[model samples]
Target: MSLLAVSNLAKRYRRGGKPFAAVDDISFEIGPAETLALAGPSGSGKSTIAKLVLRLIEPDAGRIDFEGGDFLALSGAALRTRRARLQMVFQDPLAAFNPRATVARVLDDPLRIYNIASRAERPRRIAALLERVGLDTSLAARAIHEISGGQRQRVAIARAIATRPSLIVLDEAVSALDVSVRGQILELLLDLQRQERIAYLFISHDLGVIRAVAHRVVILDAGRIAESGDARAVIADPQSAVGKALVAATPKLVRTSQDAS
Candidate 1:
C-alpha cells in the first residue's frame, strides 16, 4: 500500500484581483521507504504542495490520504496525534528554529509535546537524537546560532526524527549547504530511510540532487505536472519542454554513489 496518496489536489490564490491555481490537479503516491522528489523551477508549486501536505496551509480542492486514512479530514486531538507520524525539514534551519534556543531544548520539544519521554529522561533522549544524526552529544549545549550551518541542519533533522515519523516533507532541505556537506546530508537521509522505513516528499529544483536520492521524479511547470518517471530516466531523456529546459540549464548532472539504490 502507498504510504501517502495525493489525488487531484489543488490550491488557488488571488493574484492581481484574479484567481490562479498554484497547484492544479496534482496526484502522486509514495511507498514505504521510497523517495519521491518534486522538482520544478521557482513558483512551480513544489513548496506549496509541501505546505499543503503538512497542513501548514489548507488546500482549496482534492484529497490527501496518508497511512490509509483521510489526512485532510483529521482534526483536533486526532490531527495532533496523526501529525506525530509526519514531520518537516525546511530549507533554512536558521529561519525554522529559534536562534537563541539550545540544541537540547529544540530536540526536547517533540519528546515533551508528544509525551514520549519524562523530563528526567529527556536529556538522555536528546543526546541519543544528537548521536543518531552524527553529532557529538556535547554539541547539545550550544545555541542554534552558535553552530555551523551544517550542524544546525543536522539538529533540524534530529528533531524531525524524534517522533519516529513515517514521512518527512523536506523542502529544499539540503540546497543551502555546500557541495561536500550536501552529499553528507543526502547520505544521512538515505541511511535513515533504510534503517527506519521512512518515506520522503523531497521538494527541490536541483535535478542532480533529485537524481541522487529520488527513485521517482515529478517535474512541474507553472503549477502543473510536466513529466513524471524514474529519476534517472526522465533526467537523462527529458520529454517535456520544461524538463528539457531544466536539464539544459544545468551545466552538470553529478550523480552521487548513493544513486537511489
Candidate 2:
C-alpha cells in the first residue's frame, strides 16, 4: 500500500457570490522511502494541496489515507494523534518556530505535545534530532536569534523529524536557504529518508533540487493536475501546456542520477 495517499482532494474559498478553488481534483501518493515532488508556480495550488493532506486546512472533498486510515474521516484528538505520523517542514523555518523558545525547547515541544516520549526522554531525542538534521547539539541551548538562516531551517527540519514521523511534507523547505546550504540540507533529508524508510512529499519550484530527489513528479496549474509521471520522463519530455512551462523553467544542465535499486 502507498505510505501516503491523496485522492481527489478539493478545497475552495468563498468570496463574493462565487467560490475559488485552491486545490481541484488532485490525486497522488508517496510510497515508502520515495520522494514525490509537486511543482507549480505561486497560486497554482501546490501549497494548498500540502495543507489539505497535512490537515492544516479541511479539504472540501477527498480522501487522504495514511496506512489504511482515512485522515479526512478523523476528528478532534483522534485526528490530531493520527496525524502526528505525518509531519511538515514549512517554507519558512523562522516563521514555523516560536522566537521565544530555544532550539532545544522548540524541538522538545512536539514530543511533549504528542506524548511520544517521557519528559526525561525528550532531551536525548531533541539532541539526536538536531544532530540528524546536521546541527551540533551544543547549539541546542541557544535561542532562534542566535542561529543563521540555514541553521534555523535545520532546527525546523529537526523538529519535524523529532517524532520519527513516517511521512514528511516538505513545502518549499529549502527555498529560503543559500544554494550551498540548500544542497547540504537536501542531502541530509535524503540520507535520513534512506535511513528511516521515510516518504517525502517535497513541494518546490526549483526543478534542480526536485531532480536530485524525487522519484515521481506532479505538475499543478491553476489548482488542477497538469501532468505527472516518472520524474525523469515527465520532466524530460512534457506533453501539456503547464508541463511545457515546467520543462522550460527547469535548469537546462540538470544532473541526472540513476539508481533504481
Candidate 3:
C-alpha cells in the first residue's frame, strides 16, 4: 500500500462572495521512499493540496489516508501524534521559523514536541540535525535572520527531518533560493531520501526542478489534475495543454559536445 493516499480531496473558498473550489477532487499516492511532484502555474491549487494533506486547513470533502490510518478522522492529540510522521517545509523558510529563536532551539522544538529526546539530549540531537542538513554545529547559535538564505533553508530542512518523519510535504521548498542554492538543496533532499527512506510530496511550478528530483509527476491546472505519470515520460511527451506549457517553460541545459552532429 502507498504510504500516503488522497482520494477525492476538495476545498472551497469564497471569491467575490461566490464559492470557488481551490482543490477539486484530486487524488494521488506516494509510496515509501518515493518522490511525487505537483507542478502547475500560479493559482493552480498546488499549495491548497499541500495544505489539505497536512491538515493545515480542513477539506470540504474527501479522504486522506496515511500508513493505512484514516488521516481525516483524527483530531486533537491523535492528530498531533499522526502529524509527527508527516511534516511540511514551506516556500519561505524564514517565515516558517521564529525570528527570535536560534537554530538550535528551532531544531530542538520538534524533538521536544514529539518527546523524542530529553531536554539534556536535545542539544546533541540539534547538532546532529544541523550536520545532517550540511550545516556546521556553529550555526546552531545563530538566529534565523542572521543566517544566509541557503543556511536558513537548511535549518528548515533540518527541523522537518528532526523527528525523522516518514513523509515531508515540501511546498516550493527551494523556490526562494538562487539557481546554485536551489541545485544544492535538491541534491541534499535526494541524498536524505536515499539515506532515510523518506517519501516526499514535492510541490513546485519549476518543471526543471521537479524533473531533477521527483520520480513521478502530477500536473495541476485550475484546481484539478491536468496530467500525471512517470516524470521522464510525461515531461518528454506531455499529453495535456497545461503539461505541454510547463514542459516548454522549463529551462533546458545545453547538450554536451558529444551530442553535437
**Candidate 1 — which pairs collide?**
none
In model 3, which runs have C-alpha deviations exceeding 4 angstroms? 253-261
Q: Give all candidates' CA lDDT scores.
A: 0.95, 0.87, 0.92
Which 10-residue window of candidate 3 scores lowest in summed lDDT? Answer: 252-261
Error of 3 at 225 (Å): 0.7
> Candidate 1 or 2, higher TM-score?
1
Question: Which wins on lDDT, candidate 2 or candidate 3?
Answer: 3
Location of the lowest summed lDDT over 10 successive residues in candidate 1: 252-261
Residue 100 lDDT in candidate 1: 99
lDDT of 3 by residue, 150-174 (tens): 9999899999998889999999999
TM-scores, all candidates, are: 0.96, 0.93, 0.96
Cα misplacement distance, residue 206 of candidate 2 (Å):
1.3
Per-residue error for 54 in candidate 2, Å, reads 0.8
Ranking by lDDT: 1, 3, 2
Candidate 2's C-alpha runs over 4 A off are 15-17, 251-261
Task: For residues 11-65, write the lDDT of model 2, one tens digit per residue.
Answer: 9997697899988899998889999999988899988988888888898888889
